[model samples]
Target: MIRYIKNIFLGIYCLLQGMYISMLNMIRPKVTEKYPENRGRKEMMERFRGLLTMPHNEQNEHKCTACGICMINCPNGTIQVISRKEPDEATGKEKRVLDRHLYDLGSCTFCALCTIACPQDAIAWSPVFEHTVFTRNKLVKQLNREGSKLEVKTGKS
Candidate 1:
């Protein structure tokens, strides 16, 4: 009889403790984002990796050397670096130039290996995460812009 009474008291104490916690939470400010309503004001965290991009300068020049390192480093076959032989004006010798840099967003795991492995810092993650698409073909992107040329560093500092 005594043990039963003690169990009842313990259960009431536990119930009161739970209620206290619930009351405390109810009085606190809401942390849940309003989502669609607050879409304009919504901001992604700084470290969020959304998509891969190749940055170009004001002169429409990029630092990618078409080394194929990014493609090789990718765990999946998400990156493709196509190159073509062109005659260098200064040396008058055949040089490999980047014809295209293709990135398949559909297959990419966003492991960031390609960006990390790039020796030229050619690739980076874009903050824009809106990737809604009707077809998978749309996910494949050409990183290099038309008429964009490789930015070669001049004299060593």
Candidate 2:
């Protein structure tokens, strides 16, 4: 009977301690942000990697040389390159042409492998990460646009 009474007293003491801790937590300030209510208005990080944009020169021409290095180096095969052979008038040597460069951003890991592998210094990572699309097809971007070039040399320093 005495041991039973002692155990009940100890249990009560533990329960009171737990209640005290929970009450303290309830009064503490929370840093959790309420979502949807603050959507689109919130600021994004500076280093956040988002959407890919093709860069253009003053003439609005692309600089891609149709090199297959980027396509070969991509781990997920997210980049596709189409090349055409044309004869150089001065050198008379058959030069590879950059017909098309397609990039599927949906499967890209943003590891910057393609950017580093390009010999012509094509491809860049843009700071626009908030691209939420309804379908996966919308995420693919064609790099070899008529007036737009890949800004391989210029990016956030």
Candidate 3:
């Protein structure tokens, strides 16, 4: 009879302990965020990786020399580099120039493998994260702007 009474008190103690923990958690502040609303730039974290982007400078020029290093390192074949040789007007010599840089965001896992493997630093992650699209064709994008050419980076500052 005494052992049975002890077990009942033990069970009640356990139940009260669980209820105390629940009450503590219920009184704490909520941490849920309201997404899809760009309230402010302060809401974005510093290390948040979004879309892979190729930055073209103000002159509409890029650093990619069509080396195909990014395409080779991509795990899902997301990057495609197209190039053509054109005679340089200044030197009368043939130079390989980038015709297109096809980036398929649909197949891309955003592992940043292509950007990390690029020798010319041609690719990077952009902070803009609103990538909702209706069609798959819209996901496949040409990184380089139309008429934009590769700029030769001189060692001289």
Candidate 4:
């Protein structure tokens, strides 16, 4: 009988403790963000990895040599480098030229291994994270722009 009375008192104490915690939290200022309303004002952190992007210069030139280093390093087959042998203008010899650079964003884990392994520093992360899509086909992106050419750097005199 005494043990039963102790258990009842203990139960009441636990209930009151839980209620006190709940009351304290309810009185505190709300930290939840109003997402839709604050869409423009929403600021992502500096190191936030959002999307893989290949930066092109004003001349529509990119640094990707189609070396396949990025494609090889990707844990998931996210990156595809398609190249074709074209006659070099300067050398008059056949050279590998990048035809297409396909990036499957749906399969990517954002591990950044491809970016790190790139010898030409071809790929980087973009801050734009709004990637909500209904179809999987929309997720596959071509990193290289149409009519974009590989940038060649010459030794400065």
Relative to the true structure, how large is the alpha-carbon lDDT of every model?
0.93, 0.77, 0.86, 0.92
For model 3, how does the per-residue alpha-carbon lDDT over 1-157 read when each residue is reduced to its tens digit? 9999999999999999999999999999998776746455435565566877789999899988899999999988989899999999889999899999999888988888788888888888876677779999999999899999887677972
Among all windows of 10 consecutive residues in model 4, the one with the lowest summed lDDT is 148-157
How many angstroms is residue 89 displaced in model 3 relative to the true structure, after the best TM-score fit? 5.0
List model 2 lDDT by residue over 1-157, tens digit each.
9999999999999999999999999999996867678776766666556655556677666668777888899999899898878887669999877777889988998888787777766667677656688999988888767644334446753
The TM-score of predicted model 3 comes to: 0.77
> Which residue pairs collide in model 4, if any?
none
Candidate 1, residues 61-96, lDDT tens digits: the string is 999899999989989899999999999999999998
RMSD of each: 2.3, 5.4, 3.0, 4.2
On TM-score, the candidate that comes out on top is 1
Question: What C-alpha lDDT does candidate 2 achieve relative to the native structure?
Answer: 0.77
lDDT of 4: 0.92
- Superposition error at 115 for model 1 (Å): 0.8
By lDDT rank, best first, the candidates go: 1, 4, 3, 2
Q: Per-residue CA lDDT of candidate 4, range 31-116, in tens?
A: 88898898979887777789999999999999989999999999989999999999999989999999999999999999999988
Query: Which pairs clash in the backbone of model 3?
Result: none
- Over the full model, what C-alpha lDDT does candidate 3 score relative to the true structure? 0.86
